[model samples]
Target: MKETAYLLQAALISAWWVGLASNGVFFAAFQFDAIPSTAFWAFFAPDVILIAALSTVRAYKQNSAIELVILGAFAYASLYCVNATVLTASGYLPTGLMLLGLAYNGFLCFSDSAFRVSSTSMTWNAIKTLIQTVCIWTMALVIVPYVILDAFDTFALPSMDIWLIIGGLLFACFSLLGLTSAFFMVRDGAGTPLPLDQTNHLVVSGPYHYVRNPMAISGIGQGLAVAIIFQSVPLLIYTALGVLIWQLVVRPIEERDMTRRFGESYVQYCRHVSCWIPTFGRRGT
Candidate 1:
C-alpha cells in the first residue's frame, strides 16, 4: 500500500511539473504574441535548472514526501502565474483548463499519505489547515487592506526602490525558512507542524535552536514584507495583530501542549531558547 501511494505521488508530481512547464511556454508565447516551438524549450530549460537545484538539496530527496509537496506547490503556482498572465494579456480566461488544473492539484495534495495517521484523520487535518490558511491570508492580505483600509484609493504599490527589493528578499528568505522548519518537523520529529499532527520529538535543531517559534517569525516577517512592499498601513496593522494574537492566544496553548507531551525535555529547551528573539551562541537543549 505504501509503495503504491509513493508511486501515485510520484506520478502526480511528474504530471504537475510537465503541465507547469507547458503552461509557462504558453504564457511566454502569449506575452510575445507568437507561438514558436522554441518557446516551449525556452521555458522547459528553466524547469530543468530548477529541478537540478532541488536535487542537490538533501531535504528535497524523493523520500521526503513533504518536500515533494512543496515542490509541487511551486509548480502549481507557476501554472497559475502563467494562466493569470495570459488572461491579463489577452482578456480571455481558460476557465476549463484552469478548473481542471485546480482539481487535479487538489487531488494530488489530498491523496498523498504525508502523515502516519489514519487517512480520515489526515484528510480532516489537511482540510482544516487549508481553510485556516485561506481565511488568514485573505484577511491579512486582501480584506483588511482593500475593504477596511480603503487601500484601493489610499495606497499605491511602492516604487521599485531599495526598500522594495529588501522586502522581497526578506519575504523569500523567511518563506523558505518557515518551510524548512516545517520540513524538519516532518523528517526529524516524524510528524507535521499542524496541531492535530503535532511533532512527536522536540525540534531543537535548525531555526529552532536560535528561537522558539521560527515559523511564526517567518509568517510575521512575510506579512510585514508584503505590507512594506505595497505600502499598506492596514496590512501592516493586520500583521501586527496577527503576531499579537499568536503571542497571547496561540503560543500559550501550543506551549501547554508541548509541555504536556514532552514534560521536562520541553521545559529545559524553553529555558535555553528565547520565544521570539534569536539568541546566537546559546547552547541548544
Candidate 2:
C-alpha cells in the first residue's frame, strides 16, 4: 500500500510541475498577445494539478490536522490563481497580479513544516496571528493616518526625487532582510514568530547577531520608508508612535516571555545584544 501511495504521489508531483510550467508559458504567451481569449483552460490545468498533488501528498504523508489545514490553504491558492487569471482576461491585470502575489506570500508564510505545533493548537494560533496582522496594519496604515492625522485631505503621491527614490530602495532592501530573518527563525529555530508557536531553539545567528529585534526594526523601518516616500508629516508621526508603542509595551512583554522561557541564556543574550540598534562587533549568545 505504501509503495502504491508513493508511486501515485510521485506521479501527481510530476504532473503538478508540468502544469505549473505550462501556466508559465501561457502567461508569457498572453504577455506577448500570442494567446487567444479562451486560454482560461491553461489556468484550470494547474489548478487541478495543485489540488490532486495536495490530496495525494496528504494521503501519502499521513498529514496531521494542521497539515491538512496547510494543504487546504494550497488548494485555496490554486483556486485563487485561476480566479486571478480569469480577472486578468477581463482587463483587471494589475489587481489580478496583486492577488496572485498575496497568495504567494500566504504560501510562504504558512506552508512550511518547520514549526512544531499540533493540529488542534495551531488552528487557533494561526487564526489569532492572522487577526493580529490585519488589526496592526489597519491601525498603522489606515486608522492613524487617514482618521487621526487626516492625511488623505492633503494626499498626493510622492514625487520622484532622488531622496524619495533612495527611501524606496531602502524600503525594499529592509523588507527583504526582515523576511529573510523570519525564514531563518523557522529554518534554524523551528518556530514561527507568534508566541503560541515560539521557537524551541535559541536563535542567535543571522540577523539576531546584529540586533535583538530585527523584525520590529523592519516593521518600523517600513513605516518610516512609506512616510519618507510620501513626504507626509502625519505618516511620520504614525511611525514614531509605532516605535514608541513597541518600546513601551511590546518589548517589555516579549522580554519577560523570553526570559521566562529561556532563563539564563536569554539574560546573557540581552546583556550582549543591543535592543534596537545593531552592534556589529558584538557576539550573540
RMSD of each: 16.9, 16.6
- Top-lDDT candidate index: 1
Candidates in order, TM-scores: namely 0.51, 0.50
- Considering summed lDDT, which 10 consecutive residues are worst modelled in model 2? 25-34
Write model 2 residue lDDT over 178-232, tens digit each, in one string.
6666666666666655544676667788888878888788878878887877777
How far does residue 156 in candidate 1 sit from its true spot (Å)? Answer: 4.2
| 241: Cα error in model 1, Å | 0.6
Clashing pairs in model 1, backbone N/Cα/C closer than 3 A = none
In candidate 2, stretches whose alpha carbon ends up further than 4 angstroms from where it belongs are 1-152
The TM-score between candidate 1 and the true structure equals 0.51
- Model 1, 43-68: lDDT tens digits are 44454344333333323334555446
What are the lDDT scores of the predictions, listed in order? Answer: 0.58, 0.58
- Residue 98 CA error for candidate 2 (Å)? 30
